[model samples]
Target chain A: MTTTPAADTAVTAAALALGDDALVLSHRLGEWAGHAPVLEEEVALANIALDLLGQARVLLSMAGDEDELAFLREERAFRNLQLVEQPNGDFAHTIARQLYFSVYQHLLHDRLASGDGPFAPLAGKAVKEAAYHRDHAEQWTLRLGDGTDESHARMQAAVDALWRYTGEMFQPVEGIDGVDWPGLESTWRDIVEDVLGRATLTLPEGPRTGAWRAGAGRQGLHTEPFGRMLAEMQHLHRSHPGATW
Target chain B: MVTTTPLEEQLLELAGSVPDPELPVLTLRELGVVRAVRAHGTDSVEVDLTPTYTGCPAVEVMSLDIERVLREHGVREVTVRRVLAPAWSTDDITDEGRRKLREFGIAPPRTGAASGPVRVALGPTRTREGGPADEPEPVRCPHCGSPETELLSRFSSTACKALRRCLACREPFDHFKEL
Candidate 1:
């Protein structure tokens, strides 16, 4: 059966949203390349960043040509969720963000792998990587949370500050349709709760609904920060389209 | 009368012949990454490999390479399975493989030296007392065999390597991390 224009667009948009999340978070993680708390962790974070970058390349490249979808599109035309676009506040914040995002990505990719979609193969490949990322993040979360008093305090502050953004990750965007998968958000919540419990951290209870401060990251509408990130990422490509080393 | 190659001999030869794509000098056999090789029937062979590093990107390419090489050698069907548990390590690099790495300009990793206590220094707001430093240990220069060397970069061309420069030779080379 031929896919209708509307259906194809919806799939394309949903893919872009997912792609943007990977891309922005990859960028944020790249910021920690030389600056991690330890040398081993520096390598670990960079490796994780490279994995996310690879995923972004495949996902975004599939959304359109690698050039147009990543570079030519304007801020509003991009579709990353806001949680990924948020700044990496500190080491603790970065770890907290990773904990939440990796858990969500692992669950989402696990479910998506079984779906009868063209993206299933890609998701299958990504599930393995995401599983490792989740493990890495969870390890850090436990370490920071259960470490000394200073580390514990910093980690708790990070959790409090970033918890609000967690809600948006599970919130489905309108206009990006065709995702009829079931139980993904609940699965995500269960995984997060299990991890948090293991980490010996209490889940912060807050209003799940609030004023949506960050908007349109998934619909190609992104914050000013995304533009800067894209500018840096796309500079080489935009300078010489079709240039190969 | 034509001679038939025994399945064990053929399997051993097939597996022993395949080289790791990333580090060409080491064979899967020498690295101990190749866990098992089995013949399914007269025409099919299965190769099992464990990754040397947790996130080695070359594992996929290496699997495909194994299949291609086996097919070229007349194995009709080949399957490469990646086993995760009992992870491969530098300790698994055979002595011959260690010599090969040294001859190829990359240092063979020191066994049982993968990780140690690392001191990290936080800024003035920091409670930690010391700065980032690994415990003192002799890392022999891969090129000159001198024990004097300094770290140049934690990251190298590949994830498994770190860049270190030898004081004696004054050449930068990739030192395969113990991990």
Candidate 2:
């Protein structure tokens, strides 16, 4: 089957977008290695981070190779959605971010698995893992949401703060042309609503089409925060090119 | 006819005996990681293994172990390959291996279930009481004969198992998911 040049470019961009999301989030989650709220949760978050990193490695490697895709790409060339690139605010905010992104990822992966594209198989493999990520986030969300008043308040504030970023998850980028956008959007709405119901959190309703606080991360245009993130992520690799541990 | 060289037989025996580094009771044969073994034209032996989990640290140790065992059997040049497709599952754990894991104090995962099938079902099976849709069959705690177990953590020592503590025996055991 011959893919038109446009289609090929689009597919490549879509894969990069997906891969970048996993890579950035995996790196962010890795920061919680020994800094989690509890011991059991530290292990759990680490495991989840590793899983995301594993997925990122495969997806990024598939996008190109290990070195080229990871080390070679410039900050402006990245296409991950902004939500993933957002700083892990606090314990409550991190869990809140996990809940939002994992829910989106689970739904996105589930739908993409059935799509008629090269990404289908990758999505199929990743969806199972992402499902667990969503479960982990959901469990934490419930515990935090239903726990003490302080915990509930913190979690609620987190959810509210992160809600603005959720819009971009469903927004279709130019590179992902020919995707089943309607179906994906519907699935995202349904899953997000269900999870929000369980967490006893209200969905923040607003004008869906409004100026984003953070500009486009999907268009290879990222916030200044991404530049700082890249500096730290690439420091060692750039310093010692072709060096291996 | 001279019996097949003791070297060949010994290598085969060593290959057969090397247990999976993750699930130590299960031989790589039972785990289905050992794909093939062949004498590499004379002085060398080639062995292939697939990783049970992506980026599993144990795969490196298992590869080294294979080389050590084969060297002991007077063979050199062991090759281990990481095959990604047809991913490993708890279902691959043989019945005999399951028994061995139980004896070793680490509970073998239940055959056929993925990491947390019951918990995965919890969302769709949400009722007034928050039970599963179709009541999940009792998961026997491999530590004791008790069905009174609670899921303590989903992430265990490995991704394949969940940490469950038995209420009856007060022991934490790995419930191999019924893959």
Candidate 3:
């Protein structure tokens, strides 16, 4: 198609926002490499991480150099959702994060895939992979939420703790054309509520709206844990600049 | 439409003949990743390769292998461009590729399933066929050809396959999951 400088800048901003989300979450999931509770779970998490990493590479490349965008960017420059940068506290917490983010991502990509835009091609491909990731989270949520007193308690607590971060996901991102943000948000709530109901867990009563919502990653603002995570992530690349296998 | 020259056709064949880095049993042609090959003046060529999964690590190796193979076949330069529009699907795998996958102890993905967003069905894996519009035929075990197979894990050793075990033979095998 045709584009002006303003449209190109908007596309770049949107690409960086989406790309940073994938890159940050991929690294967080990759941290579970040797620490997963089981072998199968470890493989599954890594596989999902790889998928996100692949998406990150494509999206970041659309904005600028993928490696530089990922490794050299300061903490205040990242545009990822704060929810994705949250540490993997426990198995239950990680699954909760996956459930919220994948549902939003899958739905968003599904909409983007149906559009004629810069992100449509990658969205068309990633939507399928996101379906699997969403399924994985949903299955785990059901098992843990309905399993036993302790598992159910942990799952409930995890979802509630992360509830505040849910609101930021529905915020409209620039250059992502042709999406019904409010409709998507309502649908997200319905899906999450159904899953939680089936899992025998109560929906978090935390405020997900209003001015106090936990977000601002899109504006290069992040939570306390993000700086440490970025330091650890960029160390290797910075130490050995221009290194290759 | 531009008709491919004989040299382009031959170069396409050479590029497509490269074996997949992950599944050596299938060539890139059989896998349906090598979309097309174009020749620019006899010495320079470009090949189109689509990834099975967005993050499939094999794509890099496949590109390198294709370049090496085409270059050795008398082309001075080779360029492999990754195409993502009309995203690659399991349905793209050739019938021969499916048969070879089954022969190699991996159940092939069911064809004819509509490509798009799929609902998450969480529960015990059943062996029912024609159950619903979304659910296609049951994945039969490649070893014993038993239909009583259950999904163990959605993500297996690779992104494109799922780990499943046959209830009859108690053998676990990877099934190329539908994208």
Candidate 4:
């Protein structure tokens, strides 16, 4: 579709929001390359990370130069949700984060794929990848939430801790058309509730968003951990501009 | 669909003949990634390719191989573009390609189902029952031709394959997952 300049700016904003989400989370997941609890788990996380990275490249390229957008941009300039930049505290915490984000991404992509828009082609492809990611997180959630007393407690704690960041996900992104934000949110909640119920855990009773923090990250206001994460992610590229093997 | 000239058709065949960088046993044609080829003129050609997976690292190598093969065949300028619509599915693999994959000791993906993520049950047997009719067919052992196989890991040596083990023969093998 041909977009006017104003529309193009909105599209760029939307792309940056979604693209930054994928990019930041992929880096966080990649951090488990050496320290994952098991060999298979490590491979699985890396594979998921790679999928997200690929998606980030496509989405970022839609906005501007992919490398410059990923490496040169300052932290405040990023439009990713704060949920993605939260630290991966433990295995359960990571799974919780994955569960929260993958479900939203999958649902969003599913909707986007059905529409004839700028993102249709990408959403058509990425929706499937997001399905696998959602399944992976769901599988882990089931296992950990029901496995043992300590495991169950940890899983519950992780989900609870991450609950506050989730409300930002349902906020309407500009330039994205034909989305049912409330419908999407309700569906997400229902699916999450079903999964948690099946896993023998209860949905957290905590607030979905902290006061004054709704959609903060989309405004380029991120948490403290995000700054440190960006430093590490941007270091090599910043040190040697345009250097390649 | 656009009808191709004989020259474009010939270039398509050459491009499709390039072996997949990750799976040497299968050509790009067999893998269904080489989507379309159009010649801009006598020497310059534009080829449309699709990735098997978004993050498949081998796509770069596959593109390079296609360019090299086409260039060697007297095409002076070759451009490869990645397309994403009508996303690639495991079902896109031709029947001959599936046979070749099985012969190569990897279980080919089960066909005739709409492509999406396979649901995991996490039960002792890890089997799905009473699901919709479109539920995927069982993945048989490439080694023993047994339907009793179990998934070991969703992600394997590559994104397209899943690590599975045959119950009958107890041999670990990779199954090209239904994308």
Candidate 5:
């Protein structure tokens, strides 16, 4: 059961990518802690955020010190998905981001969990939690998509706004296997389409590939919003280093 | 590694009885998180535990509680180790623990089903002996004996339970999610 050095390095990098995604999104969701439109949603979002945070802890710890990786890393050094670091524009926008990401996450975890990959244990444990996360997002998508004209429009626009970020998720990450990206992408689209249809919203007619694809979070080139978000996230930790709570 | 002592064994019993922070009705022993309590020499104690869920925040509190309880009992030093190798599952919850959950207004984890995807229902009493039934037997209401129930949410106040509403009692209760 020896892993080649190249393979080991690849798995570590992939883990870093996935870890960053969870860490960033967890922070974004945590921002909605008190400001959620409803009380139940606040708890729900927090629960999801905590779940992702737990995952980030495990994943980042695999690469290096979890605290250092999460708090000390520079903005250009982060490898999180751009979609996750995107602002929680509104409740509708947050849900839209959640729907796309959770679906991808669930499928990715499922694939990993079903195999003998380096991440099998974590994936096996996380897949169930991710299932609930996906369900939570799906249920909300259905509710908000079908709730009212105003709600529907907002949700639809959110889906449209975040569509570009979806392309980067399926990019072939080295040292990772067992994930069928095309199949995963199709499944993601199918599920999103079903939810959008049930909500009576149309898919945004935009390019998700070629010249219009939005990505490079894997390469540590994030969108403009990420720098400010990273500063805010690391502020308290950076402010009081070596001070035990 | 130190051998067990009489007083250290007593401390194990007390530590095992420490109630889970979230599910107060169940003890750490009943929940099966207390894997071992070894005596690290005469004055020190070490207790091993596993979390119900990998990311459950309560695990830290549970560790601190174990230490606090043991120290309060005049044990000089306490160490709580979190082990993650074999991993924890719902099946780890003992029969006493399951019964306690039900008695505490929470539905217990239903047995006689595969660990795969399940269709949670409040319908009829279907079982493995019932032969090739695709669906699980309904989660009976913890408040009332009614099988008429609805899954309100896949999550509840915590990760281990789903929010359920009983049509008979019109009360929303937690159903320990089968992990």
Candidate 6:
């Protein structure tokens, strides 16, 4: 009853792509639980992660069992961007990653929400939460980038280091609402530039295009870090297969 | 404002009054997220509820709680469905809900004007006093009933709150964010 055959398949593919993005990033943020720099940030990051997890639950459940989709999927089956699966290098790196992903998520959700597509209800709902996620990232980016010398250096390094992975987010996913990716990219660039400039940081010079630009996570391919991360994420659910809490 | 049959009225009096899992102070009815509670065929009842936020984790729990509560009261069949067409808004929180939220130590949703940071279906993100010149004043502290409070952070312990510290009471309170 959820859909016709063709629509279901298309929706499933689109959901998995977007859902994996949120699920993987949620797990990555969950990794910060006991390790974030401060107690407040521990709560804040967890809030954002939980929000993503909730979105992931709805999106993944649209295709199949959320628990199975999240816990049982092999690393290569994941369609998340390589950027999200990257390790939390440091607090600054984490914030930088959040900044990139949340803005894209916000804009993407906004576009989807404006349409009558199947993803609209969820996306319309999700974009608001993504706004907060972006705000959280922006707040810290500004504070860290313009703060003490150590903080500024770390923030700058994090931004520059993660620039390459961002390109994968813009790759067209089949069945997602037809969005103007070129326009989205430009908007993202403008927003990031404004925020980073105000924070006294420069735009990352790393390649985001051409043959050398890092990407390809969309085709169920991922980097080395993802394998390890996925293993850890799946361990608990795998430990007691078929057990329910 | 709710129009229902006598049987539905009986069901709603119980089913609609379920407290929100996150706020706990406001009922689903008072919060206005309970869209409907009526008969769903011969011997079954259905409750329609929407989440405060699309991603609020409490929505599922709230649904489960509603089912549990109704079944415990001898309702043979119950179904909880979530709808998204007419999306939920902070404006839907009733005045009674706001009063209850204050008693529960969380500042209620802003009464009028978009002063708090809330997102909706359309338009650019217009944040509070930062841009909107006609936006209302800051939410008052719930503790001392004072107008003097400093916002500690827009993101708080929960998605629907902003952390505010009262200048009068020196107490950190949760302001139910507009959204």
What DockQ do you compute for every candidate structure? 0.06, 0.26, 0.79, 0.58, 0.31, 0.39
Better by DockQ, candidate 5 or 1:
5
Distance from true position, residue B126, model 2, in Å? 15
C-alpha-based local distance difference test score of model 2: 0.71
Q: Residue A245 lDDT in model 4? A: 83
Distance from true position, residue B155, model 2, in Å? 1.2
DockQ of 6: 0.39
lDDT of 1 by residue, B1-179 (tens): 53335775777667767788888888888777877777877688878777765446787777888888888878899888876444455677889998999999997777755333111110111112133454434566777787667766545677667677877778878777664
Evaluation by TM-score, superior candidate among 2 and 3: 3
Worst 10 residues of 5 chain A by lDDT: A206-215
lDDT per residue for candidate 5 within A1-245, as digits (tens), equals 78788887888888899899999999999999889887667878887888898888888988889999998999878888888989999888999999889888888888887888778878877776787787778777878889888888898889999887888888877668878888988988888898788878787667664353445888888888999998899999899996577
Model 1: per-residue Cα lDDT over A151-242, one tens digit each: 88888888777777776666564433334434666777777777667767777678542465444455455555767777787788788887
TM per candidate: 0.61, 0.81, 0.97, 0.96, 0.84, 0.91
Give the runs in model 4 whose Cα sits over 4 Å from its true position: B115-135
Q: Write the per-residue lDDT of candidate 3 for residues B6-32, one digit (tens) a residue.
A: 988988889989999899999999999
lDDT digits (tens) for residues B33-97 of candidate 4: 98999998899999999998887899899999999999999999999999998888888999999
Residue A98, model 3: lDDT of: 100
Candidate No. with top lDDT: 3
Docking class of 1: incorrect
Error of 3 at A159 (Å): 0.6
**Candidate 3: which docking quality band?**
medium
The sequence of per-residue lDDT tens digits that candidate 3 reaches over residues A83-156 is 99999999999999999999999999999999999999999988888999999999999999999999999999
* Each model's lDDT: 0.70, 0.71, 0.91, 0.89, 0.81, 0.82
Clashing pairs in 6: none
Candidate that beats the other on TM-score, 4 or 6, i.e. the better one: 4
Q: Which candidate, 4 or 5, would have the higher DockQ against the true structure?
A: 4
Residue B36 in candidate 1, Cα distance off native in Å:
21
Top of the candidates by TM-score: 3
State the lDDT at A168 in candidate 3.
Answer: 91
If the candidates were sorted by their TM-score against the true structure, best first, what order would they fall in?
3, 4, 6, 5, 2, 1
